[model samples]
Target: MDGLPMGRRAFSSTSPSFRATARVGVAATGVALALLLVVAASGCEPVPDGTPYDLVLAEGQVMDPESGLDAVRWVGIRDGRIATISQIPLAGADTLDAAGLVVGPGYIDLHAHGQDEENHRLFALNGVTTALEMEVGTAEVDEWYREREGQARLNHGVSVGHLGVRIAFYDDPSDFLPSGPGGYAVATDEELDTIRSHVRRGLEEGALGVGMGIQYTPGATRWEVLEVFREAATHQAPVFAHVRGFGVEEPGGSVEAFLEVMGAAALTGAPLHIAHLNSMSLEETPRTLQMFEEALERGLDISAEAYPYSAGLTSIQSALLDRYETAPDTALERLQWAATGEWLDRESFNRYREEGGAVVLHLNTPEMEALAIEHPFTAIASDGRIRDGVGHPRTAGTYARVLGHYVRERGKLSLMDALRKMALIPAERLQEWSPDFRDRGRVREGAWADLAVFDPETVEDRATYAEPALPAVGFHHVLVNGIPVVRDGGVVEGVAPGTGIRAGSWSPGS
Candidate 1:
């Protein structure tokens, strides 16, 4: 209730004939009044005075990276949208004292693999409002969206995944990624047509985009990948891809794999998003970033994301680790069994490969990871997943780790820039394809009232590799669809305000 009031500019006086100046002033006032009336008729009028807002966050350091707003302000939410942003206080049905806290747009994770209740809670606790499974998305796109509607804690969506379609086609026993014939069996021309049809159907069902895990489906030919890209292009859908291979080892290395997909995007004119640029490139992260920058300069619709961590996680049975059968002990020791947090030897690696479980690979260096995270163009995303408290730490820790360690502790990037990477960049990447995202990722009036309020000095990730489920600390409040899912550092009980996000054109079950 203690702040400066909003003010309007005052008209200046000049030397002129009194009658002429009076006439000009009166005419100007008439035009302005006409314009104001027109605006009010068009439903652009300001909120009526003395009418209480649904919710108000008072005296927070409001930061909107898009508009470069960094000052204390009061925010009023009404009907799940930000209705007022005032320099002074606002009255509301419910009010939160946000003094000394940073109120920014809730983070958006473009590569989230955790969409279940457990992970959604973690994401909300960590200040993420929308967590999308874009890397390896669902095969039954409509069913996937339907299952989460009104049940999820955070906004959710999925792509129509190439990996899932291939696995389903081959009847592969693996659930998440291809491990058997799906990985090794090549598709015939007719089979390729069937795959393209499924991709097209998913788009028609309102999938976020085409999700491709080419590395997991090794048998998918270059031509097959291109045809899928073409299908996505026809729908004006972007392709979120895990390139075909990893490492800088020559021949079937990261360079070759990246070029293959880059070529696909170029040939078909499909927008491309490179998933987890840090993990996929490892030591070659800088080089890959350069390639991405150059491609952007050449008018390619390309973007990349990275989590703030030095390790990666995946199923031991994935085709990505097929060479581990012949790999030396040195290479095998880099893996840590996610179930028990024990380092793996050749014997343990082989045993886990047969047993089929998640394995954490200590593959990247801190320096290389920092390079990707610190890049201006790279968005922050948690390519994260966990089940029953057993998985990598990135799922629970990514955003906070970036804020606490990268921005606050190390001074790697400004707070605004960090928020931009976490919120705005990811939203912009998908807004072109999905109308659900157009007003997201900002703190402006009329934007969605999805917000994260946190104590900048105290916020930090508590989740560790050994204890992966530990929720982050110092998030004072998180709101989804203008409802508080987290308040005063704890999750609000029994609330499910999240809704399914899809492409603009498709309706439910259409």
Candidate 2:
């Protein structure tokens, strides 16, 4: 009995009380010793002497991917941070019965484009606590942060995008993504200097990092991209890039496009994050992933993200589809007009290209998607955006889809691994430059109380191409900064607890 098995030891024995008792060399009497043994056997941390916690989640499977913690514990939240995690129940002013639920760090979307109230509400239902516009970030970093300062429902941030800068530089006719001169005009030496100035200014204004939609701005020369990478490096910022090409079209295919950014990263020591590796790599996902892995092994500070989806959404007018005219009729047929959910032919494709809007391209195969998603190096990000409830399913379903389809149904990876991709990995990607991320993406004490409590059995995405705005199901409660944004499986209206998540090193004046 004295040498009880490790597995049978009390879970609460890891509590601060046990450590305190050990350090103080306290001896216990028969009754006191029995109480101590029972408490240890019960796995509840010895209740510290303190006022009751502000809120407590009781009897839940708390999963923290950072520490590989998977156990039933009571989580105590106070003043927007986790105060304690105990195996035994603790007193709280407010408590939620979290029985049969998994309480974990809220998901973080590093590539979310929809930062408005509408999208934030959906993001909450999807268990996303922080939604970042990293792939096609805003040109107006200050304005972007200011707009969402107190209006957003979930934590938000943005990157300063090269596409936005280029669009403004050329006075592009289209919004969001360039369709006119911004897409096609090659920059002169002076023009490059002007673009570089705007990029530097954006970073100075406290952008999370630089966003480069390389495919959208085909006119940007390799040297011009290298120049932008230099600017990001100057500020110790990462470059989140949509690599220049898609598919295996030789010359400028996915392999070469990946190399371009990796090369820039190597030359300038700029950290790089490739956006939507599944969409960017297309048919060559495996090869590009290998390349990404090799580059990481070579000591490059680089990472990639992918959503659990096959089709990708982008503006039909983007340079990405400039080749649509020459693309086989079969290819054109696969482009689904988001407005009507109708497949487009050459005529429809051209018509939509002239009248720019979102188009859902059914591009990659399921096999290819599974490959990218299952890879260990990739983080889970929703390169998702919705405007007036009219966007890709990914805008709403990305996270839940991963939890439901990939983790639960297919068993491609472990649930802990999925949480790591959604939470810890994304945070770690930015933590080097943004110390604010240091406390995020974990369920440990002193971490921000951004928690997502959901029923793993029924948790799933409900959004589809035909109904892209449908909110995901299974999340019972979502807390942002210890405030419930989603309660009882619905969005809690009239509350805006979201804050701007920005880099720690540089502020407005610094």
Highest lDDT: give the candidate number.
1
Candidate 2 residues 384-449, lDDT tens each? 888988999998898899888887778767777888899999999988878888888899989999
TM-score of each: 0.91, 0.91
Candidate lDDT scores, in order, read: 0.85, 0.85
TM-score of 2: 0.91
How accurate locally is residue 379 in candidate 2, as Cα lDDT from 0 to 100? 98
Clashing pairs in 2: 11-43, 12-43, 12-44
Q: Candidate 1 at 270: error in angstroms?
A: 0.6
Tens-digit per-residue lDDT, 1-510, candidate 1:
121110101011233432243244345445444443122211334447556789989767788878887766678899999987865556678998787678999999998999888998889989999999998998899999888878888988899999988888889998889999878889999999998999888889999999999989889999999999999999889999999987889877778888998999999999999998898888888789889999999999988899999999999999988878887779988899998999999888888889999999899999999999999999999998889999888999999998888876777577788899999999999998997787899998899999999877678999999999999998999999899999998999899988789998887557
Badly placed stretches (over 4 Å) of model 2 are: 1-50, 508-510
Q: After superposition, how far is residue 363 of candidate 2 from its true place, in Å?
A: 0.9
